[model samples]
Target: MTPATIPSRFGLACVLGSALLLSACAEKQVILPGERESVRPEADLSESRIRLDGNTARAIQLPAQRVNAEWTQGIGSPAFRVDHAALGGQLQHLWEVPIGNPDSRRARITASPVVGGGLVYTLDSGAQVSAVTPEGAVAWSTNLTPASERAIDSTGGGLAYANGTVYISSGFGLLSALDARTGELRWRQKLEANGSGMPLVRDGVVYVVAGDHTGWAVDAGNGRVLWQIMGAPSVTTVLGSGAPATSSDLVVFGFGSGDLVAAFRQGGMRHWAEAVAGNRLGRAVSRISDVTGAPVIAGDRIFAGSHSGRLAAFDLHGGEELWLARQGALGPVWPAGDSVFAVTDLNQLARFDASNGSPIWAADLPGFVNDKPRKRGETWAHYGPILAGGRIITASNDGLLRFFSPESGQLVGQVEVPGGATTEPVVANRTLYVVSSDGKLHAYR
Candidate 1:
């Protein structure tokens, strides 16, 4: 991949205003994933469809298997990648549980529900955290902040599961660890930077990208501050970027400015960082280069997509560009077998060649309000195209969960969720969980 001189818009630096002067910023220099040459076509704003190259126009075989038993983090796992998992006989709705207080709409659900330890964990719109049975029995529900702290103002943050613990990052600027089974608070730490999305836990560390366009590494066990990394802030961002993906020794994630960064998982030591936003076209939010998609780590390569920017692969170790394409996506792209599936900015669900970043197939989905989702604004859909069984399952705001063939992108099955899923759906123990913004948890078996 050829190196670009620009930076990513994922980090929210625009709102930084004068705060940019209060802190240090990384120099804007893009380092590619590998030594390979750039083979990507220029981004075309005119189409929601992907033009296939000769190799991509033909048939491609994708892996039909998935990881059984867990959707540990917001993006499946800390690596942000999972194989195809098996599903059951039917997509029947088993049960539903209210997520947060029903009376108030001020707090919107922002985090995907994660399942672990046979219990589904959710952080609701009202800054309330709950753990329940896969069958929808409420084991416990608790507020994350003080009574005075829970307000209609801010709604960000999510939950992550690892090592029998649940890590919570809140728009209230609080990070806390709770016992997975008991809902007991282990520790909580306040931050100068507010948490934006789901906090990822790997190798005893919890990684967070705050609203301030900064990255943090918190000790998962004790909630200690290990180290922090700062990136150029954008006046605006694409919903606080995606959850960071980790592998080898690097923790990589995108920022509001569309920057893809690689840092040591431990000490925040820099490996190589670059801008994922390929070109700066317009000043409109349409020009925002935020990489809202989480990075997918497979072997030595990391796959990522940006909103109104490029979809590219980079070398995990040395930060070299492998290949790129013009496709803007907000949710984390799913990589399985040999194909990577993405729900793009144009409302099209497409698959790309994992090895060379080639376009394999493109299919459209019903457009959701996510078309205009942003931080400090109204909530949007958490489109889930999770690969399971031999199909891809995705949820929308219309109380629907649709399934499609992984091979042909053909419609296979569909189901209606209660109140619809505002965030992405998560699966564990052969059960799929969708949490609606209305604080309702719908479980399908």
Candidate 2:
């Protein structure tokens, strides 16, 4: 693997208005598996500069929470937007099963758990894919690692399901179609480079991005590349790639180079490209401009964020910039009705007005481990601000699943994850599935 293909283990950190200042000094104690820390005083945000916009704060509303039957893709849908999914009752601890090998120094699990056909799917750091039942039983398992000396280090691919087939992208430069029920391989195609992100399948076509930043459209039935386009190359990127988001006619992909490109869904003709690159002053991690989170398309707008301190929305038709914010999104921006919720680079879960990109409210999540200052201790990374059951849901590397009020950005409730989550949680049929960094599949009802 080349330098750019290797996943970086660095935590994303940057100053976002007053949130970082408040969170950095705000003292909160969280007990890890084998460690405990003293309680610290909470920073007073009453006089802080970041505040909800008065004009839209009172009018903000989210779509009604609806029960989603299946989460077939990593981001829930081809558009990468699952607005207000219905997760019923108190999320009681249900069952847990080991998925595969956990994250090591050589590889890490970056793909979110995908649920479909009554089974939860996960891709571990070693390129192993496992399917688990709702009762936490391993139904089938398959290894996609290529037969090569360097294949042991392969990591960071994702899964998507459509019809009765599971589409898989491998870090070993292969895309394979598998039987969703039997785990039998149907077809496989070799790509020009290793896969960087999850595959998105829609209407008999599969879309994926490679490590070289190339977008490919493949036939879902047979693993044949229909069309492919090369994107601008970058030497440095965060850990993983963002899955491409698609509408009826267009598919938008975010590259590690901070380029957001939109191409025709059927053909690979470039529609437009925009750079989502910007850096926070004095922050070294902010220099990486990878769009680690998948771009989300809701209605007529496209929302995406980069690690380099930029959260932007663009017109879906012309790819024109509609609004932009300075806070880099740590994960995919959850676009509800009038607001967009994101776990920001500052370790704060913030709500932004989807209309004008105005700050609504920001709630601080766990930042540095042991509540120590950045660089002095390890920082807890957060993923997924998905709106479920009338609350904003976010999973942390600190083994906690937090729920926040969508209306106020206040912490409402939290649950302990067994081994700490490595990626975002996915909900299917009113059940939540989270993949822990220790390679366990945790299911909650």
Candidate 3:
């Protein structure tokens, strides 16, 4: 479809009325027996000894007002033709904004949509950073200097909004802080010559990994560089690497090329760096490989995945390896009750015990639908499985949004977008927001 088509699908009129009718017929929440009794299902929570208290439960609760949240860069889209009304949510086509113009020069948007106050943010391959409203109007667009001679796909970097500022990174190697409301630039810093990982902000600090096997912690409140650590050995001499994670007082990360997991006292000096062994696949590979995903911090242990299919956990305090799970792992992980969700290029959805990385359930999923007609047996890949309201909401690459039961991983309902989905589903109030690859923003109940 041409960019100007503005397909009838990307409008509120087409879906709003249908969604309102469905929302008017609300489904009463069923009080399950598990809520009243303490009889925990073996798989209800991850296989950790730490008991989940009220605080933990409350932390994951849906907020009264929707806050822009992105677990990973983009949400998962399902590979199916769907009816929007059946998904148990209202569906409204908000807006369809075009990304690269008719000219061939265009940037592929791998950065996830960042929403805050009243706007959404994303970065495209053309080194163009864009901000838009939920209604699909462009707020501002700023182009940055390209990092290298070759174009790098910015799929993994994540965006964060804190205080009154917006934090964004270019896979090419740049981090900038901009005003949240207006797209005014506050400060821009070249974290490294090359940047591939997303920045994670906590407290008042921004933790990020540099393309050159180094990690830096900067004060978010003022954009001051607090400390920098030579994460792994030099990539030229050794197979250099670094993966970052953080808690209130501690900063955690792993470096397999240097064979270490290190911790630093927040706002203080680097405390210690301990080695973590290379798995069968080790750290570096022939092409496009490294430790890239953000580490998930749960209780006292921090869990992470390496480029090589190894999922391991380490002590948040001592930087010691607690448990390691060996499996054909792929992509970033999402932690729900007791199970963490991951999808592979082979179209497999696997849930593992977050504590020990033991497999609890695994299933092969359908691949995404391309713009062209799908040939027989062709499939699309799953991008994300966001957990909310006892259901897993996922977007497929082919522009379909689906709802699945967390209990069985079975698809419940789905909606198809004229433009396929490239971002993760954002759930606020009772509305689900999804962005499509063709630059269309969709809202569903």
Candidate 4:
């Protein structure tokens, strides 16, 4: 029994007999009854690093679906939060009409179709705004590209409809107001930099952000600049814009540098500024730090997310950070009843507790080309987790509109979108409208 005198098991076995040597020295495999040998399951290379928090997974509850009359702003409303919207029944494609130029490398369709004035409005890649009637006929189309700027260069900006006018922001540094009925130009104001983001029209004021990191509050009626404030500059940023979110007293703006600034609604006085910047290690895209999704103001709290792996909730009064989650949102965060839904950077639809930022669940989305590994080809992008008709709906560049259950992360239904959706889908008057990458507006009932 002495430590040195006790030979190892392998040495003892080898010396016992040559016949037993091979069996004792080799590794063993234990097979259970009714089991057969098979290869190990392949690792899901496209899986997201975030996981469900079991404590709050079953605590999520959504509000009852209600019919929304109109979707006036690109973010659904000025506050950037829409509760469960009623969609009546399964989406049956009704009609589709060409909006304007399709998406291109130099120019992209960044604006989500807005619904108001009994018509659907869309901004195309070449700074063209088109209004389509509910019956799929083109009501009016107006080209907003200035004479000095090339059509391809005027790629960004968005659309908003309010009262009797359609508000437009163009990448060529212009803000215009046009008659909703006739598409006649009411007034156009020139800005110092390219207009980046949708114009938020609330109570006769238009709030927007520019590519130079400046926030503008303009007169909605005449396109007059009421107030302006500059945000921290960004050297590199995402391609599209982040619309401004507004409450009763303060309007919040998300900049390309991931700086979130709150200003007084009346005078544009800076209340406070916070940066939603936290890069995930080894993710090169996380370093961009752009607040691509518009900040959402729900009740007394404000929620926002950036491409740099930061989803945060702040107090509306003092800009205090209430909760922070390290998941970069690919689009606007949808805040429902007790949970907030977002399309994360990993192309997964995720639900998080609105109170504490704890993750509820995450459902994997199409990540790579044809759902293959990344090395195979290009990746696909997903947009929208809009709560409609009691289902969480998301449109993908892979040409599918996936509907998932809110209670669980299971995909309940899916529809093939022709040409693929380039922007988030909008719901209004029990109808769903989505703009395709091929410059077409598709409506479903």
Q: Against the true structure, whose lDDT is highest?
A: 4
- TM-score for each candidate, following the candidate numbering: 0.81, 0.85, 0.67, 0.86
**Which structure is stronger by lDDT: 1 or 3?**
1
Most TM-score-accurate candidate? 4
Backbone clash numbers for all candidates listed: 33, 0, 24, 0
Give the alpha carbon lDDT tens digit for every residue of 253-316 in model 4.
8889998999999899999998887887656777888886678878888888888778899898
lDDT of 3 at 87: 30
Residues 97-194, candidate 1, lDDT per residue (tens digit)? 88675324455677888877878888776578899886678898777775676456557677888989999888788888989999998999876766
lDDT of 3 by residue, 26-126 (tens): 99888767446456454353212211111111122221223323322222111110112123344555546754311112444445555556666665544
CA lDDT of 409 in candidate 4?
A: 73
Scanning candidate 2 in windows of ten residues, the lowest lDDT window is 47-56
TM-score attained by model 2: 0.85
Compute the lDDT for candidate 4: 0.83
For model 1, what is the alpha-carbon lDDT of residue 311? 83
